[model samples]
Target chain A: MSSPSRQPLLEVRNLRVEFFGRRGRLLALDDVSFHIDPGEVLGVVGESGAGKSLTGASIIGLLEPPGRISGGEILLEGKRIDNLPYEELRRIRGRQIGAIFQDPLTSLNPLYRVGEQIVETIRTHLPMSEQQARKRGIELLQEVGIPSAAERFDHYPHQFSGGMRQRVVIALALCAEPKLIIADEPTTALDVSIQAQIITLLKRLCRDHGTAVMLVTHDMGVIAETADRVAVMYAGRIAEIGPVQDVVKRARHPYTHGLMGAIPEMGADIDKLTQIEGAMPRLNSIPPGCAFNPRCPSAFDRCREEKPYLLPVERSQVACWLYDETGARREAAHG
Target chain B: MIAFILRRLAQAVLVMLTVAFIAFAMFNFVGDPINNMVGQDTSLQDREALRQSLGLNDPLVLRFGRFVANAAQGEFGVSFRLAEPVSRLILNALPATMELAIVAALLAVIFGVMLGVYTGLYPNRWLSRFFLTISLIGVSLPTFLIGILLILVFAVLLGLLPSFGRGEVVRIGWWSTGFLTWSGIKALILPSITLGLFQMTLIMRLVRSEMLEVMRTDYIKFARARGLTNRAINFGHALKNTLVPVITITGLQLGAIIAFAIITETVFQWPGMGLLFIQSVQFADIPVMAAYLILVAVIFVVINLIVDLLYFAVDPRLRIDGGRSGH
Candidate 1:
């Protein structure tokens, strides 16, 4: 758990992202903020268009064209990193932070061998010879649970199966010993059996290296299994963020509660799980008040009128009208 | 991998034989070699004697068989008017055209790739518009027009270059190169630039589209996130991946450049295989004409082989099939 006495490894404050698209400007991310402590995994769970991947990309400085970080500060170890020059930023990227993309095939360059790709990344951040980098690359592959890592060093990405390719990608991300890694849906493309293996490897690596990870996925199962703390997002905004156990087991926001309720438990015999009312609003047509208010069953008079700010409620931070002073006092009076 | 190459080699041989038979048949369809060899005043016996010695009197199939046999031994018989071996004649004129095509292709690749990569990385409306306009002009204009326009500007109007003939030939070993002389280089510029422009535009478009596509791939985003420098990401990663398609396009374009060099050669009046081909065609020099077609077919086959090899080198997926798993 992140304490007040220790500075968090990475902090994103009031992060706002926009896209000047063909249909006019759409706010992709609105005041999204979170923090990942050292050696902690922060799972960002949301729907397909919930901006979970976008947040990871924004943090990793890989937001593609049309989408740009409009406002906010990304701080790494208390140093402002959002506005660094390209060269300086690039240095920070390979040295300080690494990225694992959703699709392993897309992450690995087909022309080069997997070992070569890992070696290139290692050499880019660290001052080492080719042989040294290669040795480290093999070590990384082995650490990532790749079978026969030494012999597989010269094998191309296409030569490896989908699961093996993802393992190679993991090795590539860890080559530089980065302080933080942004893994966006790292196991989505793998087999059901392989997914667990990959998740275990990622967890073990993070623990071994004491690396902070921003694990973005729509799979709440993966989130519960891997993340220390979790951030639930809806319509590009963080609906709730707290310890994984707290957010998953004892959800604060309406969206988070609905999300946790939807997950099917093994022994429970309930046929129809609790379902939310409506879908998360489109980025272009996000409701003015709370983004999830349309689907929230507890929406009140103030929930329709004004956007609820993220406020402290115990250890978790939630952005919903129900948790506010007026809503709480009203609930007390009603009871 | 060895099996792949062996299979391609066998296919090349089959293609060469097919092209040779087609060339032989096409040549026979043209005017008689006897008419081109002997003057109008020559007697019937003399014509018969000349046809007999040249094996022209034989049946078309027998002559084709004989021609095939001779060609197999690197002999394409003698030219009708020139009275020189067709192989020697083609060999003599090959260098200038080759030099021209090589220069043009190289320039096309360098300029095209650089410009395409630049625009691909930093796509803007104005730059794309500029590329579109250039592509329109380059794609719309035929080779001859581009050649003539270049000549009219640099040769006729400016008087800076020689319009006709391959400058002085400097024989080096078995090969005679035109680019060894200063005037040869000067003569080469207009034609190479003229020939290269169309291909350059083709290459530029290919590289641009491939680069644009590759830049959006997951690897590129991952590379950027890894904090690789722009140079490393664009040139090292993006450009390298884009080259798989570009290489194939360039290889095919190289064959096209050689084929189109005939028109380019005639327009420039350059003494190359293309010039020999036109002159041989006009005079009904069957051997030279047949040899030229066979030569071109061989060039294409060789290029195909090279491209296949390169494909294997660049892409590992191509080798995944017919292989066992694991290292």
Candidate 2:
């Protein structure tokens, strides 16, 4: 754990992303909010359609066109960034925040030398000559554990193996020493064996640099292994958020509980790994009350009639009606 | 690289030999050059002498071999109608055609890629729509028709340019050029554009589609997330990626430009190899035709070789993959 004196590095409030097309409007993300303190690793876990990647993209100001931030306030170090002009946001991108994408192959420009790319990125955000940038780039490559960093600097992406290329991408993301790094499924595209190595590298890098990380992924195991705080998302809304240990050991929201149930224990004799009832709702047909209500096993009448907001529930924040006093009262009376 | 060029050169030489053989054989099938060159009133004995003197009496293979040997020495025999060295005619006419093609290709690439990149970037913008309309018009119109339209607009209506001939020629020992004077460039304008119109649109459409495709790739998204400026992402990343295909198309289209400059040259009365080819065909000038064929083939092979080398330079992936496969 880090010091409690530092403010949260990133704050997202009521982040709503919508896709507008000629057909109509589709709400992709609704009222999603979370914050990452300096040097903290916050893992966002969800199914494929849970808008985990979209939230990551929106925070990095790289949301694909037509799908945009319709309503939200994203602040980096207390300055609202969601509404800044493009140039200003661009300046903040490498200078204050960096991003690590999923696939290493596509994350790099195949036409450029890896060293030159890192150098260019360094030069773009920092006041440095080519020689200085090149020197720093080599240092970063070495820091990321690339062998013969100086010699490998002249090599292209195609010259490196997949794991080595991922290492270079990590080096590229860390070149500018940003306060925050948004990693969207950074290890999912890596080999299974190499995934842990990258995770450990990221944790070490963040810890050493005091850089906060927002790790987006659907792997609960990864969240458990690395994250300080875990947010479980279902159908574009966060079902629960809390310290990883507390949430994993004693889950609160039914959706989070179902997700945890699906992780097979080591050599445990069980009927089968538990399965969540239904697929995440499509953007157009997201249920009115709680997006997870249709698939929630403990859903009561109040869960269907009214949407619930995140509320403090003993060591975690839960959005389930079971945590609400009025909802609990109604359920007891009905029983 | 030198070894690669040498290998390519060897291949080009083989192709040129085959092309020369085809041209020589093709001549025998055409109407008798003597019948066209000499009047019908000429005595039969004299006509026979003319044919013999032109080496028509030799065996077909021998004749073709002689033609190839002379071509190797840069001596393309003599033209039937022009009664001059075929090499001289090509040398004299090449400058004008080359000047036209080079300027047109340069201008076409600049405008086409510029328009294509923006149009692909913003397909719905009014400027893109307008450029797309221009490209459509360019694609539909024939070169001769485009030439006529330019003449009407810039020549007759505006009275600002010339419509015929290669302007005033400035002879410079073994070479003469029309690009030496202001009037020469003025005359070249209408024809160069007319010849370049189709290529421009073809290149525009190619770059536009390539740009659109590259924009969708994961690298572009990754580049955006890296916080690259819009200009860097568009031109540096997207445009550089699009250039390979555009360069390829431009290379092939440049060959086509040289091939079809005949029509444009005829319409505008520009003195170039294309017009020379047209005149030689009407006169049944076999040597000139054979020489022009070989020249065009060499041009195409050389251009393609350049394009391949450029591909290796522009894309390191190509170099890496190609190097591995080469082993």
Candidate 3:
């Protein structure tokens, strides 16, 4: 067994996901690679069709029909779990790697009481007495900041407000004390005020438990606030990734720059926010060569002719030829 | 909930009264029950005297009022043909018909739900397709035809069971070994299958469609994300969500089953209320037919009320106003 201190909780490499559409097979995620060290929070940000959610679903082994991982290796605690049998995959899910979904109302079973759901998830992986499970369930509920956890355990999902239900969902996810948690837009369904509360709760609880999280969202503000490291995906591939501050301050990829520019700055005097020049290309009509080449403002002949690999750019990785220092230097000196 | 029940009960009473009035009007339209019961050879004086004695000579309004009063007191006037109380005859036949209908419904619901769950979970698979084909055949085939086919297969060809009629009514208590015996069950099989086949098929298709819809819900997907096994996701999450529609269809079909019982009873020769109903119609036993019609109408109303109540029980959201649509 690997020591918890040295080993990363989850590692994903060269992951490719595809969906069979009427036109042809559409690639949702292409050559996606990332790792979540123990207790790390890695935020994945992208446009609607950029496959951030697909990556999270693939990692949790919950990809639905018509969408499947075509090529990938998902390692959990140094064990390859990409091709594990569904039964084994289920055992690992919730117990080894918990998940919190975007919709709070749906993430928890409506028919069951919040407390009962938590207890059930706890007992699913642990051999414990019902009383013990019940106690632990209450503790988790209280830990998640739900008031009167004992009494509220009997309440159904509909009885709770949207924020409270999300707290319950988070509690249910944490019941098994899994090493990793994949939260897919966990706060997107809540109001703006409640969104901050939930994010704070998630950060606090995960930090206390030393649980790594792969937070998938389109909200850059959420990434800036919560993510330790950030990965920016564009058209099924990671366009850039690095430390949150590095990526936010010195974003190398044009897509990342466009995303940052689109956000409204607090002190800026600009009359209107800067929007990207064009919409993200449709899945079926993705441009040839580099998927982002058409969208990139600084595209050159080489960018149009060959797809650029994710090369190191300063403190971050950028998949654009403009950031290729050696090639830039040679062109500059010769010209 | 109490208000709903009271409202439903009031509606049920109105429906029963309407059914009674219709039955009476139909009887009157068919001409004198006395003339139909007696022969043409009877003297005119005797016919007039018989009509007066039977209260047929009274005005239409007076006769209707009298009929309603008598019905309330359980005196469905003496059967014109049998010369017995219509109430007594209907009471005697009711147990047999109720027995058949109840057992058939039970079997249908059990088998239908099982088949529906299986097919919904594995749609387009061979087993599901096979069940789908079988259910289609069941839906298309009439109850009497299915009954005759079952008798031909189980009775005539194999001699595995009796062709018709309830076996000896052993003098044991109602809940005795005789009722529990394989012999009693063997006698009931043909009638039950005949009565149940159509309902079974109807329910299976309804349940399958409902379940297929429920399986696509976000909650089911969330359950899978929670690491629930496929069986748990299908049965625990999807099946429960599908029950409201199934319950509604089952309740509606119960009314149809009552109507079907008449034909099934005639085919099988089981001395149920349905058979009694046909015999009364042929012999112009007006009282018995009216009583039977009223009883069936009451059963329909009661079943619908129960289904409405069940909606609240199955889905908590329905307890609040406008929650049924949410589910």
Candidate 4:
């Protein structure tokens, strides 16, 4: 997945998102960059307000007012999409990049039949007649595991349970068979047991459809189970990005290390789970040097003054001075 | 669906019966109808004979039963003032009031929903702001004052419309319609606006707020994310959701238009039920007064029933979940 020779399906380069408020301009996401390869699941794991969802929203061109991408080049298959006009961007939205939000209860319009919504989306991007779209809608519904797809087609969103509605949403997102699907906390609102079902459904769908996905969530357990690569976001910046196994087993960034440590392991002998000491910083008052420096256990003099961008560290790209020459030499001497 | 409607109809019947009882009660407090019908010089024998013939001498419950029976047969005795059948007077005035109300309601709903959606979609646009400001005036101004102002501008200044009355109505059997004749249509313009302005503004404001609220919902965001065109997203997705509330307000407002067209009728001297009711009040015409109150109640009941049915049609959640096997 990290093979640089192949062109990525989606590339977000040095993305910066800012909010204009009464207090003046505040940077929400600064220089956040990552890529998702075709048919790959790139998990974006972060705490709330970590710009995980914001990144997805920005990519899909649905950022609410006063929050905008101030600086970034969002290239979809080598074409710039960040600067496209609304009409053009809309044409690209479901046709090339689809989105799935957190709550299935509120995601589908309650007034429309689940089938009608799917059919409408299909017809919007594809040159299909209503009947054709409807047929495809039923097939897609079946594909997403909705029981009795044809019968469920006429049912309202309220008729479906939370998990079923999410399946309908996933069916809707995949209507046009877009290159990528942005699942923003798709299972966060589902039951713990149903969450695994949805995750499995999502994983199988992506594989079958060959659709790349930007899986944004705070659940590391979900990320570990489903994602091929994972990017750990800390205060609107990518603290680490690499193969999921490497990032989870050998987290190069301290924030990623602290994050992985916090997750409780089954059958472990520890009495208390590892907990990060400080809260994530707010946008207006994020620390000057590295946004995570205040909370970093290895923070030294230089770490407090200069921000570190993504640098190659083993198999992962880490944003920490601990991976630099001095730190490496110190580690060598200690070893 | 049939059961829902049947239940609503049963409720409406209950409501209408209750209104009829209240109307019946009004006759006792409104003074004797015989006194207004007869002269002071009439002998006691003659007065007694008239009362006996009219069923006034009967027991109260029996008289009420007869009254209810007559009312069910569409016979509301005779008006004390006009000395004609109460049903005929209302029938004659019914067309005028109904025409005025329907026209006003059409104007209100059409323009109200349009302006509301426009303002909700683009709250900062200059035209939207202008509509909003105009709505504020519409909502704040009294109906009579609005009617008078409309007459002043269109009738007095421009001399383009009739200041009073239903002009040149064409008779089509029992129904006299203002829709066919040109002068009749022109005559309707000022009074309808006067009658409907408040309701129009109310509907517009409700729709605008509802549209704004619906536009911000997660479904709307998902609709946009799904690449539906702006028009489809706003009107199809957002507007459809706004309709359940809009229908409720618009329905109630329509009933208000018919019931409260009194001021507009008085200002314009339109030959409608409102004007007839006012005249009946002046003359202490108990029969006509009671009939008018009952009619208004019926209108309210029917409109409310319609509103409830519209809800069932518009919102699937309100419908009993018919078919499903949930896992």
What's the TM-score of chain A alone for every prediction? 0.95, 0.96, 0.95, 0.96
Off by over 4 Å in 4: A1-5, A326-335
- Estimate the Cα RMSD of every predicted model relative to the unseen true structure: 2.9, 2.8, 3.5, 2.5
Q: For model 4 chain B, where is the 10-residue window of minimal lDDT?
A: B318-327
Candidate lDDT (C-alpha), each: 0.85, 0.86, 0.84, 0.91
lDDT, ranked from best to worst = 4, 2, 1, 3
What stretches of model 3 exceed 4 Å from their correct place?
A1-5, A21-23, A326-335, B27-30, B33-66, B171-183, B320-327
TM-score of each: 0.93, 0.94, 0.92, 0.96
The best candidate in terms of lDDT: 4
Kindly report which residue pairs in candidate 1 clash with one another: none
| lDDT tens digits, residue span A174-261, model 4 | 9999999999999999999899999999999999999999999999999999999999998889999999999999888888989999
Worst 10 residues of 3 chain A by lDDT: A106-115
Error of 3 at B19 (Å): 2.4
Better of 1 and 4 by TM-score: 4
Per TM-score, what order, best first? 4, 2, 1, 3
Clashing pairs in 3: none
lDDT of 1: 0.85
Tens-digit lDDT string for candidate 3 (A122-158): 7778999889999999888899998877878777788
- For B1-327, candidate 2 gives per-residue lDDT tens digits of 667779988988888888888887766777776786788799999999989998899898888888788888879877888789888889989988888888788778888888888899998899999989989999998889988988998889999888878887787886676678887777778888888888888899999999989999987887776677888889888999998888899988888888778999899888899999999888778889988998998889889889888987888876544222100
